[model samples]
Target: MKIRLWLIMAIMLAAIVLAATGCGATTGPSTIVTSQQNTGVWVSGQGKVTAVPDVAILTLGVQVQESSVAQAQSEAAAAMNAVTKALGDKGVAGKDIQTQRFTIYPIMRWDESKLQEVLVGYRVENSITAKIRKVDDTGSVIDAVVTAGGNFTVINGLSFTIDDPTDLLGQARELAMKDARNKASQLASEGGVKLGAPLYINESGGFIPIIQVPIARPGIGTPPS
Candidate 1:
């Protein structure tokens, strides 16, 4: 009887250990499942609008060299003033003329023999951007400035663009939205699903075409020392 009792106690202890450890449980090692619910389809669309530019932008300037910084700056200022008067003569409004850049720096020549840089003279550059409403007058305005500013005149670059781009941007936005709607509808048809109303909308950007003007280097005689 004592042997039988010991055997029963051993069986009971094994049952208690299995219950504590959950050995017979079917639940796998605490598995976690993640799922992304499909909400809607995403589509991207683009639109472009182009038109001939009505305004011309020119970067005109005068650069002068002198032995002293004050002298160079004075000469540059005089030349730039003359250029501004020339623009005014061509009917460019005061609001349309803006000083773009003005700089004064010492001219340094690299001396290869001495392995150093030698100061030659002070160079002053004064520049302004003029928006010409009359695109056809671009050449005449440039010529007039050159004549007025004389030997220090410099024509940096020219570009053509529309004065106002609001209308163009609006048209492009409408077209882009239409394109997106059409694409979404097509996708919904192919996938055998109903397209829901747009819950969100975003505009990437509008395209503006730039008309590159040929670089024209104006001839300016050497500055008087």
Candidate 2:
């Protein structure tokens, strides 16, 4: 799927300096310096890049409930092991499979006769975050994991993103600079001034991932491990 890389930069403006000997006024931030003495108009600009996602991230796990903690843990462990193996068989590297959570908690039920809650059994959950570098194989990988985990499979969520955003960020930054300069030029022209050079530029940027949320997310009362 298509993903976006958005970038914005702050091109601060300062007062223009008067030229000597009938020379032109100094340029600032690739546009004519604002001569408004702290009353200059503030311009905002953004540069965006659209690209295909190179990676797929999956949050998946296995959960089991049994009358005893050991039984729950054993079943959950076997299912999770199979899930990890399935990920590997689907070309996911070992380094990409990371255990995110493992919890065992009492499954409680209300005892109407005693007017108190009693532990009927225990629930064990084991989850992992796996990264699939081959984005095209995401669907097959998910299928394999689900099949391996069987009835206890829990697909928390999935997301698509760039593995390394350094290059994309650099490209976006260049575009943002160009966009800012263009806007600055427009402002200068409207204010009846010639375009000059840039004076101050401060760049800030962030990345947003494209996520495919599940229709239902499991409640998170499981104890952390």
What is the lDDT, from 0 to 100, of the residue 199 in candidate 2?
Answer: 44
**For candidate 1, lDDT tens digit of each residue in 140-211?**
888899999988899988877778877777766666666777777677677666655554455555445345
**Can you tell me which runs of candidate 1 are displaced by over 4 Å?**
1-37, 110-117, 219-225
C-alpha lDDT score of every prediction, in listed order? 0.68, 0.69
Residue pairs that clash (backbone atoms under 3 angstroms), model 1? none
lDDT of 2 by residue, 1-225 (tens): 333432222232223221221123453334434463243434545667656677888998988888888888888888888999999998999999998999988888888999999888898889899998887777788889888888788888987777777776776767776777677667766776655444445565455556564524433324323
61 Cα displacement, candidate 1 (Å): 0.4
Instruction: Estimate candidate 2's alpha-carbon lDDT, on a 0 to 1 scale.
Output: 0.69
For this target, which candidate reaches the highest TM-score against the unseen true structure?
2
For candidate 1, what is the lDDT? 0.68
Distance (Å) between predicted and true CA of 199, model 1? 1.7
lDDT of 2 at 205: 49
